[model samples]
Target: MNTRTGKVIVNQTITADGYSAGLDQTEEHPFGDDGGDGWGSSLHSWMFDAGEENRAEVDQINAASAVIMGRNMFGPVRGEWDRQWNGWWGDNPPFHAPVFVLTNHAREPQPMEGGTTYHFVTDGIESALKQARAAAGDGDVSIHGGATTINQYLAAGLVDELRLHIVPITLGAGVRVFDGVPPRKLEQVTARAASTVLHVTYRVLA
Candidate 1:
Protein backbone atom coordinates (compact mmCIF):
# COMPACT_ATOMS: atom_id res chain seq x y z
CA MET A 1 0.00 0.00 0.00
CA ASN A 2 1.18 3.49 -0.85
CA THR A 3 1.42 5.53 2.36
CA ARG A 4 0.96 9.30 2.30
CA THR A 5 4.03 9.95 4.39
CA GLY A 6 5.38 12.69 2.16
CA LYS A 7 6.06 16.17 3.56
CA VAL A 8 4.89 19.60 2.45
CA ILE A 9 8.20 21.08 1.39
CA VAL A 10 8.83 24.71 0.55
CA ASN A 11 11.68 24.76 -1.91
CA GLN A 12 13.00 28.17 -2.93
CA THR A 13 16.16 29.87 -4.19
CA ILE A 14 16.72 33.12 -2.38
CA THR A 15 19.38 35.82 -2.23
CA ALA A 16 21.63 36.45 0.74
CA ASP A 17 19.26 39.26 1.76
CA GLY A 18 16.26 36.92 1.78
CA TYR A 19 14.71 38.28 -1.42
CA SER A 20 13.39 35.67 -3.73
CA ALA A 21 12.99 38.06 -6.65
CA GLY A 22 13.77 41.64 -7.59
CA LEU A 23 11.49 44.59 -8.34
CA ASP A 24 9.53 45.43 -11.51
CA GLN A 25 8.65 41.89 -12.56
CA THR A 26 7.77 41.77 -16.24
CA GLU A 27 7.35 39.25 -19.02
CA GLU A 28 10.86 40.07 -20.17
CA HIS A 29 12.20 39.57 -16.65
CA PRO A 30 10.14 36.84 -15.07
CA PHE A 31 12.38 36.54 -12.03
CA GLY A 32 12.99 40.30 -12.02
CA ASP A 33 16.40 42.01 -11.57
CA ASP A 34 19.26 40.46 -9.66
CA GLY A 35 21.36 43.66 -9.28
CA GLY A 36 24.03 42.34 -11.70
CA ASP A 37 23.28 40.69 -15.05
CA GLY A 38 19.42 40.53 -15.12
CA TRP A 39 16.43 38.33 -14.38
CA GLY A 40 17.51 34.96 -12.96
CA SER A 41 21.17 35.46 -13.82
CA SER A 42 22.24 36.01 -10.24
CA LEU A 43 19.56 34.18 -8.24
CA HIS A 44 19.21 31.06 -10.38
CA SER A 45 22.72 30.63 -11.73
CA TRP A 46 23.27 27.75 -9.37
CA MET A 47 20.66 25.61 -11.10
CA PHE A 48 21.64 26.50 -14.67
CA ASP A 49 25.30 27.52 -14.56
CA ALA A 50 26.40 24.98 -11.95
CA GLY A 51 23.92 22.17 -12.45
CA GLU A 52 26.58 19.45 -12.29
CA GLU A 53 27.85 20.72 -8.97
CA ASN A 54 24.32 20.76 -7.52
CA ARG A 55 22.88 17.76 -9.26
CA ALA A 56 21.55 16.22 -6.05
CA GLU A 57 19.75 19.39 -5.02
CA VAL A 58 18.35 19.84 -8.53
CA ASP A 59 17.03 16.30 -8.51
CA GLN A 60 15.48 16.76 -5.07
CA ILE A 61 13.67 19.87 -6.28
CA ASN A 62 11.94 17.95 -9.05
CA ALA A 63 11.37 14.80 -7.03
CA ALA A 64 8.07 16.10 -5.61
CA SER A 65 4.96 14.18 -6.58
CA ALA A 66 2.92 17.38 -6.71
CA VAL A 67 3.67 21.12 -6.78
CA ILE A 68 1.86 24.27 -5.63
CA MET A 69 2.74 27.76 -6.80
CA GLY A 70 1.26 31.23 -6.83
CA ARG A 71 -0.30 32.79 -9.92
CA ASN A 72 2.68 35.07 -10.46
CA MET A 73 5.02 32.09 -10.44
CA PHE A 74 2.73 30.47 -12.99
CA GLY A 75 3.21 33.35 -15.44
CA PRO A 76 3.35 37.12 -15.89
CA VAL A 77 -0.41 37.27 -16.47
CA ARG A 78 -2.38 39.12 -13.81
CA GLY A 79 -5.96 40.06 -12.84
CA GLU A 80 -8.55 37.68 -14.34
CA TRP A 81 -6.19 35.99 -16.82
CA ASP A 82 -6.42 38.46 -19.70
CA ARG A 83 -4.72 36.02 -22.05
CA GLN A 84 -3.97 32.32 -22.25
CA TRP A 85 -0.75 31.67 -20.41
CA ASN A 86 0.43 28.13 -19.90
CA GLY A 87 3.40 28.55 -17.55
CA TRP A 88 7.01 29.66 -17.37
CA TRP A 89 8.17 26.20 -18.39
CA GLY A 90 7.46 24.90 -21.87
CA ASP A 91 5.15 22.04 -22.82
CA ASN A 92 7.06 19.56 -20.67
CA PRO A 93 7.55 21.13 -17.24
CA PRO A 94 10.10 19.65 -14.86
CA PHE A 95 7.60 18.68 -12.18
CA HIS A 96 6.26 15.74 -14.23
CA ALA A 97 3.38 15.54 -11.73
CA PRO A 98 0.22 17.38 -10.80
CA VAL A 99 0.75 21.10 -10.12
CA PHE A 100 -1.83 23.11 -8.19
CA VAL A 101 -1.64 26.83 -8.91
CA LEU A 102 -3.14 29.36 -6.49
CA THR A 103 -5.08 31.97 -8.40
CA ASN A 104 -8.09 34.16 -7.78
CA HIS A 105 -9.34 33.54 -11.28
CA ALA A 106 -10.62 30.13 -12.18
CA ARG A 107 -9.16 28.20 -15.10
CA GLU A 108 -9.59 24.81 -16.61
CA PRO A 109 -7.08 22.10 -15.87
CA GLN A 110 -4.25 22.34 -18.37
CA PRO A 111 -2.71 19.04 -19.25
CA MET A 112 0.84 19.09 -20.53
CA GLU A 113 3.26 16.54 -21.88
CA GLY A 114 5.37 14.20 -19.71
CA GLY A 115 2.58 13.72 -17.15
CA THR A 116 2.50 17.33 -15.97
CA THR A 117 -0.82 19.05 -15.41
CA TYR A 118 -1.70 22.54 -14.15
CA HIS A 119 -4.76 22.80 -11.94
CA PHE A 120 -5.79 26.30 -11.00
CA VAL A 121 -7.38 26.70 -7.56
CA THR A 122 -9.61 29.71 -7.07
CA ASP A 123 -10.71 28.82 -3.56
CA GLY A 124 -7.70 29.34 -1.28
CA ILE A 125 -4.35 28.04 -0.10
CA GLU A 126 -5.76 25.39 2.21
CA SER A 127 -8.00 24.09 -0.55
CA ALA A 128 -5.05 23.95 -2.91
CA LEU A 129 -3.05 22.05 -0.30
CA LYS A 130 -5.83 19.54 0.13
CA GLN A 131 -5.94 18.86 -3.58
CA ALA A 132 -2.16 18.71 -3.85
CA ARG A 133 -2.02 16.24 -0.99
CA ALA A 134 -4.62 14.03 -2.65
CA ALA A 135 -2.69 14.11 -5.90
CA ALA A 136 0.65 13.52 -4.22
CA GLY A 137 -0.26 10.38 -2.26
CA ASP A 138 3.01 8.81 -1.11
CA GLY A 139 5.09 11.48 -2.86
CA ASP A 140 5.91 14.84 -1.34
CA VAL A 141 3.92 18.01 -2.08
CA SER A 142 6.43 20.70 -3.02
CA ILE A 143 5.52 24.36 -2.58
CA HIS A 144 7.20 26.10 -5.51
CA GLY A 145 7.04 29.74 -4.54
CA GLY A 146 7.49 33.38 -5.47
CA ALA A 147 7.81 34.55 -1.83
CA THR A 148 4.24 35.80 -1.35
CA THR A 149 2.77 32.31 -1.60
CA ILE A 150 5.48 30.81 0.58
CA ASN A 151 4.98 33.55 3.15
CA GLN A 152 1.28 32.75 3.38
CA TYR A 153 1.98 29.08 3.98
CA LEU A 154 4.65 29.91 6.47
CA ALA A 155 2.43 32.32 8.33
CA ALA A 156 -0.32 29.76 8.46
CA GLY A 157 2.08 27.14 9.76
CA LEU A 158 1.30 24.79 6.86
CA VAL A 159 4.80 24.07 5.67
CA ASP A 160 6.51 20.93 6.91
CA GLU A 161 10.03 21.34 5.59
CA LEU A 162 11.72 24.49 4.37
CA ARG A 163 14.50 23.95 1.86
CA LEU A 164 16.40 27.03 0.85
CA HIS A 165 19.04 27.43 -1.84
CA ILE A 166 20.94 30.46 -0.66
CA VAL A 167 22.76 32.35 -3.40
CA PRO A 168 25.74 34.60 -2.71
CA ILE A 169 24.43 37.83 -4.25
CA THR A 170 21.87 40.21 -2.73
CA LEU A 171 18.91 41.96 -4.37
CA GLY A 172 18.68 44.79 -1.82
CA ALA A 173 14.88 45.02 -2.22
CA GLY A 174 12.29 42.87 -3.89
CA VAL A 175 9.73 40.19 -3.12
CA ARG A 176 11.19 38.59 0.00
CA VAL A 177 10.69 35.42 1.95
CA PHE A 178 9.28 35.52 5.50
CA ASP A 179 7.92 38.97 4.98
CA GLY A 180 4.71 38.38 6.95
CA VAL A 181 5.57 35.09 8.59
CA PRO A 182 5.51 35.00 12.34
CA PRO A 183 8.38 33.83 14.49
CA ARG A 184 8.80 30.08 14.64
CA LYS A 185 11.42 27.57 15.68
CA LEU A 186 13.13 25.59 12.97
CA GLU A 187 15.30 22.54 13.46
CA GLN A 188 18.12 22.21 10.96
CA VAL A 189 17.68 19.02 9.00
CA THR A 190 20.60 19.15 6.59
CA ALA A 191 22.98 21.57 4.97
CA ARG A 192 25.22 21.34 1.90
CA ALA A 193 27.44 23.80 0.10
CA ALA A 194 27.89 23.87 -3.64
CA SER A 195 30.03 26.00 -5.92
CA THR A 196 27.34 28.65 -6.51
CA VAL A 197 24.71 28.00 -3.83
CA LEU A 198 24.23 26.58 -0.37
CA HIS A 199 21.37 24.15 0.19
CA VAL A 200 19.85 24.09 3.65
CA THR A 201 16.91 22.08 4.90
CA TYR A 202 14.97 22.81 8.07
CA ARG A 203 12.11 21.07 9.78
CA VAL A 204 9.36 23.52 10.72
CA LEU A 205 9.02 22.81 14.38
CA ALA A 206 5.59 22.89 15.94
Candidate 2:
Protein backbone atom coordinates (compact mmCIF):
# COMPACT_ATOMS: atom_id res chain seq x y z
CA MET A 1 0.00 0.00 0.00
CA ASN A 2 3.03 2.31 0.26
CA THR A 3 3.87 2.56 -3.41
CA ARG A 4 5.89 5.66 -4.18
CA THR A 5 8.09 6.88 -7.03
CA GLY A 6 11.84 6.71 -6.70
CA LYS A 7 12.31 10.32 -5.69
CA VAL A 8 15.70 11.41 -4.35
CA ILE A 9 15.15 12.74 -0.83
CA VAL A 10 17.29 13.99 2.05
CA ASN A 11 16.58 13.51 5.73
CA GLN A 12 18.85 14.88 8.41
CA THR A 13 18.74 15.78 12.11
CA ILE A 14 20.53 19.01 12.83
CA THR A 15 21.02 21.33 15.80
CA ALA A 16 19.53 24.78 16.01
CA ASP A 17 22.85 26.14 14.73
CA GLY A 18 22.41 23.96 11.59
CA TYR A 19 25.17 21.52 12.46
CA SER A 20 24.65 17.86 11.81
CA ALA A 21 27.89 16.89 13.57
CA GLY A 22 30.51 18.40 15.80
CA LEU A 23 34.31 18.39 15.70
CA ASP A 24 36.56 15.34 16.33
CA GLN A 25 34.46 12.47 15.10
CA THR A 26 36.12 9.16 15.96
CA GLU A 27 35.14 5.53 16.32
CA GLU A 28 34.20 6.25 19.91
CA HIS A 29 32.49 9.54 19.21
CA PRO A 30 30.35 9.05 16.10
CA PHE A 31 28.84 12.53 16.19
CA GLY A 32 31.91 13.96 17.95
CA ASP A 33 32.01 16.14 21.09
CA ASP A 34 29.19 18.63 20.71
CA GLY A 35 30.04 20.40 23.94
CA GLY A 36 28.82 17.25 25.63
CA ASP A 37 30.55 14.23 27.12
CA GLY A 38 30.30 12.46 23.70
CA TRP A 39 28.08 9.84 21.99
CA GLY A 40 25.71 12.57 20.69
CA SER A 41 23.13 11.40 23.19
CA SER A 42 21.23 14.66 23.21
CA LEU A 43 21.25 15.29 19.47
CA HIS A 44 19.97 11.79 18.66
CA SER A 45 17.97 10.93 21.78
CA TRP A 46 14.77 11.10 19.72
CA MET A 47 15.85 8.13 17.60
CA PHE A 48 17.72 6.10 20.21
CA ASP A 49 15.16 6.33 23.01
CA ALA A 50 12.04 8.27 22.06
CA GLY A 51 11.37 6.55 18.73
CA GLU A 52 7.62 6.21 19.02
CA GLU A 53 7.14 9.91 19.70
CA ASN A 54 8.69 10.61 16.29
CA ARG A 55 7.17 7.57 14.64
CA ALA A 56 5.94 9.36 11.55
CA GLU A 57 9.34 10.70 10.55
CA VAL A 58 11.01 7.47 11.58
CA ASP A 59 8.69 5.49 9.36
CA GLN A 60 9.25 7.90 6.49
CA ILE A 61 13.02 7.37 6.78
CA ASN A 62 12.67 3.60 6.97
CA ALA A 63 10.35 3.47 3.99
CA ALA A 64 13.16 4.23 1.58
CA SER A 65 14.31 1.37 -0.63
CA ALA A 66 17.93 2.45 -0.81
CA VAL A 67 20.10 4.85 1.17
CA ILE A 68 23.17 6.92 0.32
CA MET A 69 25.42 8.22 3.12
CA GLY A 70 28.82 9.76 3.58
CA ARG A 71 31.77 7.73 4.81
CA ASN A 72 31.64 9.40 8.23
CA MET A 73 28.02 8.47 8.72
CA PHE A 74 28.87 4.90 7.71
CA GLY A 75 31.71 4.70 10.26
CA PRO A 76 34.91 6.34 11.51
CA VAL A 77 37.20 4.64 9.02
CA ARG A 78 39.44 6.90 6.97
CA GLY A 79 41.81 6.86 3.96
CA GLU A 80 41.65 3.28 2.82
CA TRP A 81 39.80 0.14 3.98
CA ASP A 82 42.81 -0.81 6.09
CA ARG A 83 40.79 -1.90 9.09
CA GLN A 84 37.94 -4.41 9.33
CA TRP A 85 35.32 -1.79 10.10
CA ASN A 86 31.92 -2.85 8.87
CA GLY A 87 30.09 0.17 10.19
CA TRP A 88 29.00 1.92 13.39
CA TRP A 89 25.94 -0.26 13.47
CA GLY A 90 27.07 -3.61 14.78
CA ASP A 91 25.61 -6.63 12.96
CA ASN A 92 22.21 -5.20 12.10
CA PRO A 93 21.66 -1.60 11.06
CA PRO A 94 18.50 0.51 11.18
CA PHE A 95 18.37 0.67 7.40
CA HIS A 96 17.14 -2.65 6.08
CA ALA A 97 17.61 -1.65 2.43
CA PRO A 98 20.72 -1.35 0.32
CA VAL A 99 23.02 1.50 1.49
CA PHE A 100 25.63 3.09 -0.75
CA VAL A 101 28.46 4.83 1.11
CA LEU A 102 30.31 7.69 -0.58
CA THR A 103 34.03 7.17 -0.11
CA ASN A 104 37.27 7.39 -2.05
CA HIS A 105 38.51 4.17 -0.54
CA ALA A 106 37.23 1.08 -2.24
CA ARG A 107 35.96 -1.96 -0.38
CA GLU A 108 33.92 -5.02 -1.14
CA PRO A 109 30.21 -4.98 -0.47
CA GLN A 110 29.53 -5.80 3.15
CA PRO A 111 26.21 -7.47 3.75
CA MET A 112 24.53 -7.23 7.12
CA GLU A 113 21.46 -8.55 8.83
CA GLY A 114 17.92 -7.47 7.93
CA GLY A 115 18.71 -7.40 4.19
CA THR A 116 21.00 -4.38 4.46
CA THR A 117 24.09 -4.34 2.27
CA TYR A 118 26.80 -1.67 2.37
CA HIS A 119 28.31 -0.85 -1.01
CA PHE A 120 31.43 1.25 -0.95
CA VAL A 121 31.48 3.73 -3.83
CA THR A 122 34.86 5.00 -4.96
CA ASP A 123 33.67 7.00 -7.96
CA GLY A 124 31.65 10.04 -6.79
CA ILE A 125 28.28 11.27 -5.60
CA GLU A 126 26.65 10.96 -9.02
CA SER A 127 27.75 7.38 -9.44
CA ALA A 128 26.55 6.48 -5.98
CA LEU A 129 23.19 8.13 -6.65
CA LYS A 130 22.78 6.21 -9.90
CA GLN A 131 23.32 2.92 -8.08
CA ALA A 132 20.97 3.94 -5.28
CA ARG A 133 18.20 4.87 -7.72
CA ALA A 134 18.59 1.59 -9.56
CA ALA A 135 18.34 -0.35 -6.33
CA ALA A 136 15.42 1.74 -5.13
CA GLY A 137 13.08 0.94 -8.06
CA ASP A 138 9.61 2.27 -7.29
CA GLY A 139 10.47 3.11 -3.68
CA ASP A 140 12.21 6.28 -2.56
CA VAL A 141 15.99 6.81 -2.44
CA SER A 142 17.09 8.52 0.77
CA ILE A 143 20.24 10.60 0.92
CA HIS A 144 21.25 10.00 4.52
CA GLY A 145 23.80 12.57 5.59
CA GLY A 146 26.27 14.17 7.98
CA ALA A 147 26.09 17.64 6.38
CA THR A 148 28.93 17.34 3.88
CA THR A 149 27.29 14.59 1.86
CA ILE A 150 23.94 16.33 1.68
CA ASN A 151 25.69 19.54 0.59
CA GLN A 152 27.11 17.73 -2.44
CA TYR A 153 23.66 16.57 -3.56
CA LEU A 154 22.19 19.97 -2.79
CA ALA A 155 24.94 21.66 -4.75
CA ALA A 156 24.34 19.37 -7.71
CA GLY A 157 20.61 20.17 -7.56
CA LEU A 158 19.61 16.52 -7.26
CA VAL A 159 17.49 16.35 -4.14
CA ASP A 160 13.69 16.44 -4.47
CA GLU A 161 12.46 16.70 -0.90
CA LEU A 162 14.26 17.93 2.20
CA ARG A 163 13.26 16.79 5.66
CA LEU A 164 14.96 18.38 8.62
CA HIS A 165 14.48 17.32 12.23
CA ILE A 166 15.74 20.45 13.95
CA VAL A 167 16.73 19.96 17.57
CA PRO A 168 16.49 22.72 20.16
CA ILE A 169 20.20 22.93 21.05
CA THR A 170 23.04 24.65 19.20
CA LEU A 171 26.53 23.24 18.59
CA GLY A 172 28.33 26.59 18.29
CA ALA A 173 31.21 25.15 16.23
CA GLY A 174 30.46 22.04 14.25
CA VAL A 175 29.87 20.81 10.68
CA ARG A 176 26.82 22.85 9.84
CA VAL A 177 24.28 21.84 7.23
CA PHE A 178 24.14 23.89 4.00
CA ASP A 179 27.69 24.96 4.72
CA GLY A 180 28.63 25.59 1.08
CA VAL A 181 25.34 24.82 -0.68
CA PRO A 182 24.10 27.48 -3.06
CA PRO A 183 21.00 29.40 -2.09
CA ARG A 184 17.64 28.06 -3.19
CA LYS A 185 14.03 28.62 -2.19
CA LEU A 186 12.21 25.73 -0.51
CA GLU A 187 8.47 25.11 -0.64
CA GLN A 188 7.34 24.10 2.84
CA VAL A 189 5.19 21.01 2.59
CA THR A 190 4.56 19.97 6.19
CA ALA A 191 5.63 20.87 9.72
CA ARG A 192 5.22 19.18 13.08
CA ALA A 193 6.40 20.28 16.48
CA ALA A 194 7.21 17.60 18.97
CA SER A 195 8.46 17.74 22.55
CA THR A 196 12.16 17.82 21.58
CA VAL A 197 12.28 18.48 17.85
CA LEU A 198 10.49 20.44 15.17
CA HIS A 199 10.13 18.32 12.03
CA VAL A 200 9.90 20.29 8.81
CA THR A 201 9.49 18.94 5.29
CA TYR A 202 10.13 20.97 2.16
CA ARG A 203 9.92 20.44 -1.56
CA VAL A 204 13.18 21.55 -3.13
CA LEU A 205 12.11 23.91 -5.90
CA ALA A 206 14.24 23.93 -9.01
Candidate 3:
Protein backbone atom coordinates (compact mmCIF):
# COMPACT_ATOMS: atom_id res chain seq x y z
CA MET A 1 0.00 0.00 0.00
CA ASN A 2 1.20 3.53 -0.76
CA THR A 3 0.90 6.15 1.93
CA ARG A 4 1.70 9.85 1.73
CA THR A 5 2.86 11.16 5.05
CA GLY A 6 5.35 13.61 6.62
CA LYS A 7 8.63 11.93 7.53
CA VAL A 8 11.59 13.17 9.56
CA ILE A 9 14.99 11.78 8.55
CA VAL A 10 18.07 12.60 10.63
CA ASN A 11 21.58 12.50 9.13
CA GLN A 12 24.45 12.66 11.59
CA THR A 13 27.96 11.34 12.27
CA ILE A 14 29.46 10.85 15.70
CA THR A 15 32.80 9.80 17.10
CA ALA A 16 33.18 6.38 18.69
CA ASP A 17 32.87 8.20 22.01
CA GLY A 18 29.42 9.40 20.76
CA TYR A 19 30.14 13.12 20.32
CA SER A 20 27.98 14.47 17.53
CA ALA A 21 29.11 18.07 16.93
CA GLY A 22 32.37 18.06 18.83
CA LEU A 23 33.54 20.51 21.53
CA ASP A 24 33.04 24.31 21.35
CA GLN A 25 32.23 24.57 17.64
CA THR A 26 33.17 28.24 17.26
CA GLU A 27 33.79 29.97 13.93
CA GLU A 28 37.53 29.33 14.13
CA HIS A 29 36.98 25.68 14.96
CA PRO A 30 33.85 24.89 13.02
CA PHE A 31 33.93 21.14 13.64
CA GLY A 32 35.76 21.71 16.91
CA ASP A 33 39.33 20.61 17.83
CA ASP A 34 40.70 24.17 17.34
CA GLY A 35 42.09 23.32 13.84
CA GLY A 36 44.82 20.96 14.97
CA ASP A 37 42.79 17.75 15.38
CA GLY A 38 39.24 17.68 14.12
CA TRP A 39 36.80 15.38 12.32
CA GLY A 40 35.88 17.91 9.60
CA SER A 41 38.29 16.47 7.05
CA SER A 42 37.18 12.92 7.66
CA LEU A 43 33.55 13.93 7.81
CA HIS A 44 33.70 15.73 4.47
CA SER A 45 35.64 12.91 2.86
CA TRP A 46 33.10 10.41 4.10
CA MET A 47 30.18 12.43 2.80
CA PHE A 48 31.54 13.54 -0.57
CA ASP A 49 33.29 10.44 -1.81
CA ALA A 50 31.91 10.17 -5.30
CA GLY A 51 33.15 6.61 -5.66
CA GLU A 52 31.00 5.45 -2.77
CA GLU A 53 27.33 4.61 -3.41
CA ASN A 54 26.47 6.50 -0.19
CA ARG A 55 26.87 9.77 -2.08
CA ALA A 56 23.89 8.78 -4.18
CA GLU A 57 22.00 7.96 -1.01
CA VAL A 58 22.73 11.43 0.33
CA ASP A 59 21.55 12.98 -2.93
CA GLN A 60 18.27 11.08 -2.68
CA ILE A 61 17.87 12.23 0.92
CA ASN A 62 18.13 15.88 -0.18
CA ALA A 63 15.74 15.40 -3.10
CA ALA A 64 12.92 15.98 -0.62
CA SER A 65 11.14 19.33 -0.54
CA ALA A 66 12.29 20.66 2.85
CA VAL A 67 14.85 20.36 5.65
CA ILE A 68 14.82 21.29 9.35
CA MET A 69 17.73 22.26 11.61
CA GLY A 70 18.36 23.79 15.02
CA ARG A 71 19.78 27.29 15.55
CA ASN A 72 23.07 26.06 17.00
CA MET A 73 23.64 23.88 13.94
CA PHE A 74 23.06 27.00 11.81
CA GLY A 75 26.09 28.67 13.40
CA PRO A 76 27.38 30.57 16.41
CA VAL A 77 29.18 32.82 13.91
CA ARG A 78 25.87 34.60 13.44
CA GLY A 79 26.37 36.20 16.86
CA GLU A 80 29.42 38.39 16.12
CA TRP A 81 29.41 38.16 12.35
CA ASP A 82 28.14 41.14 10.38
CA ARG A 83 27.58 39.43 7.05
CA GLN A 84 24.89 36.78 6.76
CA TRP A 85 26.31 33.28 6.59
CA ASN A 86 23.90 30.78 5.10
CA GLY A 87 25.78 27.78 6.38
CA TRP A 88 29.12 26.03 5.98
CA TRP A 89 27.95 25.23 2.46
CA GLY A 90 28.58 27.86 -0.20
CA ASP A 91 26.12 29.62 -2.53
CA ASN A 92 25.11 26.33 -4.16
CA PRO A 93 24.10 24.42 -1.07
CA PRO A 94 23.19 20.80 -1.66
CA PHE A 95 19.70 21.25 -0.24
CA HIS A 96 17.61 22.91 -2.93
CA ALA A 97 14.42 22.85 -0.87
CA PRO A 98 13.08 25.16 1.81
CA VAL A 99 15.16 24.80 4.99
CA PHE A 100 13.50 25.70 8.28
CA VAL A 101 15.76 26.64 11.18
CA LEU A 102 14.49 26.34 14.76
CA THR A 103 15.48 29.34 16.83
CA ASN A 104 14.29 31.50 19.73
CA HIS A 105 15.51 34.72 18.15
CA ALA A 106 13.55 35.95 15.17
CA ARG A 107 15.25 36.63 11.85
CA GLU A 108 14.14 37.39 8.33
CA PRO A 109 13.84 34.45 5.94
CA GLN A 110 17.00 34.09 3.85
CA PRO A 111 16.67 32.97 0.27
CA MET A 112 19.90 31.54 -1.07
CA GLU A 113 21.26 31.33 -4.61
CA GLY A 114 20.04 27.80 -5.06
CA GLY A 115 16.39 26.96 -4.45
CA THR A 116 17.04 26.87 -0.68
CA THR A 117 15.23 29.30 1.61
CA TYR A 118 16.16 29.45 5.29
CA HIS A 119 13.06 30.14 7.34
CA PHE A 120 13.54 30.89 11.02
CA VAL A 121 10.93 29.26 13.26
CA THR A 122 10.73 30.87 16.71
CA ASP A 123 7.49 29.06 17.53
CA GLY A 124 8.99 25.58 18.14
CA ILE A 125 9.82 22.21 16.58
CA GLU A 126 6.16 21.30 16.07
CA SER A 127 5.61 24.51 14.16
CA ALA A 128 8.72 23.88 12.09
CA LEU A 129 7.53 20.35 11.29
CA LYS A 130 4.12 21.65 10.26
CA GLN A 131 5.65 24.21 7.90
CA ALA A 132 8.07 21.67 6.48
CA ARG A 133 5.35 19.12 5.87
CA ALA A 134 3.25 21.67 4.05
CA ALA A 135 6.22 22.70 1.94
CA ALA A 136 7.11 19.08 1.21
CA GLY A 137 3.74 18.15 -0.29
CA ASP A 138 4.00 14.56 -1.56
CA GLY A 139 7.73 14.47 -0.89
CA ASP A 140 9.40 13.62 2.45
CA VAL A 141 10.38 16.04 5.24
CA SER A 142 13.98 15.65 6.45
CA ILE A 143 15.15 16.67 9.90
CA HIS A 144 18.79 17.60 9.45
CA GLY A 145 21.10 17.77 12.43
CA GLY A 146 23.04 19.00 15.40
CA ALA A 147 22.27 16.53 18.19
CA THR A 148 19.90 18.55 20.38
CA THR A 149 17.47 19.15 17.54
CA ILE A 150 17.40 15.49 16.56
CA ASN A 151 16.95 14.48 20.19
CA GLN A 152 14.00 16.84 20.55
CA TYR A 153 12.10 15.06 17.80
CA LEU A 154 13.35 11.63 18.83
CA ALA A 155 12.22 12.08 22.44
CA ALA A 156 8.81 13.05 21.13
CA GLY A 157 8.77 10.10 18.69
CA LEU A 158 8.42 12.45 15.76
CA VAL A 159 11.12 10.97 13.55
CA ASP A 160 10.17 8.37 10.97
CA GLU A 161 13.61 7.34 9.75
CA LEU A 162 17.16 7.81 11.01
CA ARG A 163 20.35 7.47 8.96
CA LEU A 164 23.54 7.45 10.92
CA HIS A 165 27.19 7.11 9.87
CA ILE A 166 29.39 6.02 12.70
CA VAL A 167 33.07 6.91 12.30
CA PRO A 168 35.84 4.96 14.02
CA ILE A 169 37.55 7.84 15.78
CA THR A 170 36.56 8.52 19.36
CA LEU A 171 36.42 11.89 21.10
CA GLY A 172 36.76 11.07 24.79
CA ALA A 173 34.79 14.19 25.74
CA GLY A 174 32.17 16.05 23.70
CA VAL A 175 28.46 16.05 22.90
CA ARG A 176 26.69 12.73 22.70
CA VAL A 177 24.17 11.63 20.05
CA PHE A 178 21.70 9.57 22.10
CA ASP A 179 22.74 11.15 25.38
CA GLY A 180 19.49 10.98 27.30
CA VAL A 181 17.25 9.08 24.94
CA PRO A 182 14.96 6.62 26.70
CA PRO A 183 15.29 3.06 25.50
CA ARG A 184 13.16 2.60 22.39
CA LYS A 185 12.97 -0.07 19.73
CA LEU A 186 14.20 0.81 16.25
CA GLU A 187 13.57 -1.59 13.40
CA GLN A 188 16.63 -1.84 11.19
CA VAL A 189 15.68 -0.98 7.66
CA THR A 190 19.09 -1.10 6.00
CA ALA A 191 22.74 -1.45 6.88
CA ARG A 192 25.74 -0.99 4.61
CA ALA A 193 29.49 -0.54 4.90
CA ALA A 194 31.64 1.85 2.96
CA SER A 195 35.40 2.12 3.07
CA THR A 196 35.41 4.90 5.67
CA VAL A 197 31.98 4.78 7.29
CA LEU A 198 29.28 2.40 8.44
CA HIS A 199 25.84 3.47 7.26
CA VAL A 200 22.95 2.30 9.38
CA THR A 201 19.33 3.19 8.64
CA TYR A 202 16.56 2.59 11.16
CA ARG A 203 12.82 3.10 11.35
CA VAL A 204 11.22 3.97 14.68
CA LEU A 205 9.22 0.88 15.64
CA ALA A 206 7.72 2.28 18.82
Q: Least lDDT summed over 10 consecutive residues: which range in candidate 2?
A: 33-42
- What TM-score would each prediction reach against the true structure? 0.96, 0.95, 0.89
Question: Where is model 3 poorest over a 10-residue stretch in terms of lDDT?
Answer: 34-43
**Taking the tens digit of each residue's C-alpha lDDT, what string does model 2 give over 1-206?**
85666889999998998988888887778788775656888888877688989998999999999999999888887898889988887899989999999999888999999999999999999999999998999989999997899999999999999999999899888788888998988999999998899999999997
Give the residue spans of candidate 1 off by over 4 A.
1-4
RMSD of each: 1.2, 2.1, 2.5
Candidate 2 Cα RMSD (Å): 2.1
Give the winner by lDDT. Answer: 1
Model 3 over residues 51-155: C-alpha lDDT tens digits? 455676677577778999987778765543366777877788788999999877778888987798889898999999999998998788888788888888888
- The pairs that clash in candidate 1 are none
Which tens-of-lDDT digit does each residue in 1-206 have in candidate 1?
A: 75547899999999999999898888988877767555688788899989899999999999999999999999988888778788989989998999999998988999999999999999999999999998998789999998999999999999999999999988888999999888999999999999879999999996
Worst 10 residues of 1 by lDDT: 30-39
- Compared with the true structure, the alpha-carbon lDDT of candidate 2 equals 0.90
Q: Give the Å shift of residue 40 in candidate 3.
A: 1.6
Best to worst by lDDT, what's the order? Answer: 1, 2, 3
What is the full ranking by TM-score, best candidate first?
1, 2, 3
